[model samples]
Structures are given as C-alpha cells and as structure tokens.
Target: MPYNTSYVPNYIKRQARMVLLLLVLFTGCTEVIELDIQEVEDGLVIYGRISNSNSANEVIISRTRGPETAPTPISGATVRVIDNNGLVRIFLEKEPGVYTMQPSDSPGDFGNSYRLEADVSGRIYRTDFQELMPIIAQDELRYEIGVERDITSSGANIENDVVRIFGDSKLPSDLPEDFFIRWEIEEVYSTLTAFLPVFWFPGAGGRGQCYIQNKLGADQIYLLDGRNIRRSDLNNRPIITRKIDNSFQNKHYFNLIQSSISEENHDYWEKVRTLTITNGSIFDPIVGKLQGNIKSSDPEEEVFGFFEVIGIDTTRLLMTNNDIPVFFVDPCLFLGDKVFPLLTVPFGCVQCLLDEKLIEPGCLSCSAITNSTSRPSYF
Candidate 1:
C-alpha cells in the first residue's frame, strides 16, 4: 500500500528503544491512504497549506507517491510559525484542522524570514521553510519586466521570450518566504483550441507542491512520475517534448505579449540562489518550454546556508553574491500578489494582499520587529 490508515506516537527517551521498534517493522513495508481516516492517532498525519492575496489556484503538500492536492484541508494538528530568528509560535487550533494566531500588531514583517514548527507529543519536526513577509509593493503603484532568451543545446527550448506584470511597488525587503512567481503571458495556442497560456512550473505545478523548485529532487522527480523514456540506465533517460521534429509549430512558439509576472528571486532573504536564467531560458531536463511566462514560484525555497543572522535588519543584507546579474539584487524579484503558498496537507496555504501602506526598508507590515530580540537559527 502507498498510504497508511493510522499513525502512532511513542515516547521513548533512549535511542535503543527507537532502534528496537524500527528493527521490528523496517525490513519491507508499503501502504497507501484513502479519504478521512477510519480512526485518529496522537501522531497525526498533519494537513495544512500556504496561500496569498492572488486568485484561487492553490496547491497542497504531498509525498512523492502522487499528484498535488489542495491543503489537506486540516484543522487539528498543532501549528507553529517560526521566524528565521528562532522566535516560535504555538498557534491555537481554532477549528478541526484550522489553526489561528492573533492578528499581528500589523501584517507579517518582510525584512524578517520565518519558518514553521509542528509538534506531536514530545517530537518536534521542521519543514525546510519558515514564515515570511509578503513580496509586493506599498507606495508606488505598479511594476513590470520584459524577458527574452537565446536557445542553448540543453533540452530547454527558448520559446515565448517576454513577460510583464503590474503591482503597487516593491521594497528591498518585502519578499515573502513562500515565493510564488507567476508569469501572465499571451496565449501560445489559439484561444478556441488552447484555452490557457502554456504555464511552466518546477517539480509539480498548480496541482500542489510537486512543482516547487527544490521541493523534491528537481531532475530526479521525472523518474518518480514515469514521464521519461529510459536507455539502459535511469540516468540515461530521455525527455518527451510536446512537438517532435516536423511537428514543431512556429505560431505556437511566439506567445502573445500581455500582462504577466515571471519570477527569479533576486535576493538572499531565504539564503538561497537562483541561476542567470532569463524569461526564455530552459532550466532542467524534465522542465521544457521557456514560455514567455517563466515560473520561479514554489512554497519552500532551498536554504543552502545562512548569513549574519536570522530576522535581522536590512544592514544584514550585504550583496553576498559576486557571480550574478546587476538586475539581480535583494528580494527584488517576485509576483505582485504572492510568491508561493505554504503546503499544508489537504489544503494549500493562503496569504492576504498587502495592506496599501507605506513601505520603508525597516518597516514590515505595521509592526516592524528587529533582531534587537534575537532568536534560534533552526533554518
């Protein structure tokens, strides 16, 4: 079975106790899950999500076993919101699987990075991400960008090369933790036939967290889905592009220019780095077409390492990378509405829009918190 019917939590202070239990059940086992559980257990199969002020296309957290789902639509598990500084939150379970924290003094702080914390019994496990600020503008209303790329030998095909978007404006620090990048572009195919703009995403797109970059083994995920054709070895697998040889369509290549938002996280708020990829650049083998709408969006960004400290001031941001583009800088790249929503089980996460307020580097939401009160570096 690919899922489990129940979960159990045991309190064993010694390592020996853990080893013994694992030895009894680990040789080989498989299980799959179905709708609501027939029973409940202390060790809950948690469910939650992350979302933003944008429209309704929400994705959820899922294992490698299948496609993405909306936030598992949860309500009972304990929810913890941890700032990069280690300041932790023990959210109150307001409903069955819904957890709530008192509305903050203002909105979430942008300059500061945050993560999540979940506890079951005495065990505390952490996701690769944290709570974060909303990446948008406050004062100056609106923003836009144009993207185009040259083709390379890589399987990536440089197709639609332009992208644009409108937003209030952006501050060096307003970038959110779940950076959900969106690229609104002209439809590639005919509307009557091609109803939607060919949107590209990482690991798992729209459906859930699968499209999130770094969410899973980027290139390797193709194997899990059985989407590629193999040679002798799995490493030698081949991709299956949409149009082959003579089937290539020129009209299909040019995406109509329209309102759009492509993403490439410009800063190190989350302690990660993106490539020099432009709008039409192809990324990994599994991910083909570099449509005019490039999506650098995902709920959890990879935090390869860290800096001066978590939850610090703008001063903490010193141009850390030398090998980059001048257009690239601290938290400059993101969508007007959201980056990505946190994947909370059955239901994806949700984030509200920026409260048309003034944006100053040091000011996040209305309650600007600084490292004056430091925290742990759990991320």
Candidate 2:
C-alpha cells in the first residue's frame, strides 16, 4: 500500500491568488470582455518547495480542472527525494495528494543537488537534479509614500495614497557574478473587537482583541541578475507596495523573504510571468506550454509545476500610523444606541445596559471578521 500526504487547501489557494494578481496587473485599462476557454482532460499539477531549515518540506499534487472548477487532489502516489550523495528519503502522505518529509529526515544542505521522484498509478515522474544555492542576506528594507492614479470601472480617474517597500543587498566579491533571486512578503497585524460580553452563549464567543496574519501574493516574479549590475552591492530595489488602509490602523509588520535560485528555475518563473502578462493580446507571442523540470517516464504523459531547493534570507520591518502622515477616518464605525433595537451592540459592552437583545455577530468575536485570531509572538 502506498502512503499519501495530507491535503492543504491553502497551498493551491496561494497559487490561485498568484494567478489572479497577474491577471489584474497585466490587463490594466483593458475593456471588460470574456473569452471562451476550452475544457480539456485534467492533468497533473505539482507544487513543491525545499529549503535549508529543519521544518518539514512539502509537495502538493492535484489534477487540473476546468476554468470554472476547483482542482482535485491526486492520491495513492509514492514520493521520494534523492540527493546527489545517493541518499534517498521517502515521503509519506499525511492526507490525500499531500506529501511531507518525515520529521527524522535531514534538511537539504547548501551546495548539494536534490531530485524528486513520484510514482503514480505505475507511471514514474521525476525532476532534474537542482542544486542548492548560497543564501544572500538583505542589507535593508525601506519604504516611501506616494500617490497613484487609477481609472475606475465607470471611467473616472481616482487618486490614492500608496506605500512602496524597497530592499537592498550586497554581493560578496568571492561569489559568482551570475545569480537569481526571488522575493515574498507576509503581513501581521492586530484588530480590536468593539465589545466583550460577560455572559457567554453556547455558540457565541466573546470578542476582544484579535490578530491576523496574511501572506501577500506577489504577482510579478522579482528575479534579479548580478550580471545586469555593475556595482558589487544591489541598490534600493522595489519589492511591493499597497494603499494605506485599515490593515495599517494601529501597527503592522511586513516580512520580506529572499531566496536564491538556480538559473533554470529563474527562467521557468520568468516565462510564467511573461505568459501571464501577454495572455489574450494581439501582439502576444504563441503561448506554448511552459515546461518545468518535472518529467514522466511515459513519453505521452504531461506534467506541470516545479520542485525547487532554495537558499533563503528574511528581514522584517514594523509600520505604524505615524509612518503615514495622512489622517483617515476609521471605516469600522460603532453602531451605538441605534443597534439596541436591532440586537446589535458595540463590541466593548459587557451586557446590554437597556435590553436583552443579542449583539451583532462581528461584535461578539473578532475572528468572525478575519481568518486568524492568535497574535503572533513577534507582534
């Protein structure tokens, strides 16, 4: 019997987010139109990542679905990782189509080559060996406030304040001049619930202080090459930016993770970003299948996605309302006495001073409005 890994819906959800972001950025100012996308038989979609940490490595396998359908997990597959040292570690499925490295397995080492192999329904699939690259540390993370203009759906121009984050790093002279890098960002912040109820109902949880963490989807592949630079150190390079909103209400932290990748991996992501940007354009080049390192023993089989071993470095920065000199009103307003008749009370009240009516769902629990409730230790 073949053991399988656990299914993590978030993994694919992130991929979907990446796709959506690319579409939004690439198709700016285009007229709203729909194209008939043809349906085809589902193919294999694999997403895997490996790093130099002790944490468990993961790979997600699912069958591609139609444009209107969600992907379904592929099960009963044997998965293994082999290093150039000839040592092989088998992965067990914790859930359908999700494979994870055993806790006892050793973490990937830098300067070593690793390959992945999967046997699904007697068909063998494998990836070309990828070498682990050296990690590069970020020297600094900086930001700037500016204005951005956009045309609304109704053809009106709207200008909004925006914040852009930038990063810098230095390349040591001893290292090779040719290199590839990838960037990712995550946000952590706290939210306040208006009221806390003293008496708890069976299913009603009191709301007070809640925190949430979200990983922002990066639309563009932030791949950089040392060969393109004349200096030994990379100057201020832009990472990402966002409009000042409720997320920056009290305090927030953004973490930027930088990964050094192989030239092949860099090219793969570059092609993906290009294809996404040029999709549906008359001047667009023929969109051929973007192939990955993964391959199948059967000549007729098709595979999608990449498996990578990367060297990573991270830097975190905190931002507060003070950072943005602009003054904005709180979007989440208090219901006040008007909500008493409707059974919707403010979040801070312990009990209804006047009536026994139930409070609003969101006022009762902060988690109800956000995906996470636990505050991060660093925050």
User: Considering summed lDDT, which 10 consecutive residues are worst modelled in model 1?
Assistant: 208-217
What is the Cα-based lDDT of residue 166 in candidate 2? 72
What TM-score goes with each of the models? 0.24, 0.73
TM-score of 1: 0.24
- Output the number of the TM-score-best candidate: 2
Write the residue-wise lDDT of candidate 2 on 1-379 in tens digits: 0001111344221122123122111112212222232232377767676667544267767775644454577889999999999988777787887888888888788899999999888988899898988875445778999998999999999998988887677767666767777766666677666532233222334346667665554334455655555455766766677788777777787776677789887777655622222212111111223357789898897787678887766677888988987885543334555434434544434355224544444455665654554655556
Error of 2 at 28 (Å): 19
lDDT of 1 at 199: 32
Residue 51 CA displacement from its true place in model 2, Å? 0.8
Error in Å for residue 219 of model 1? 24
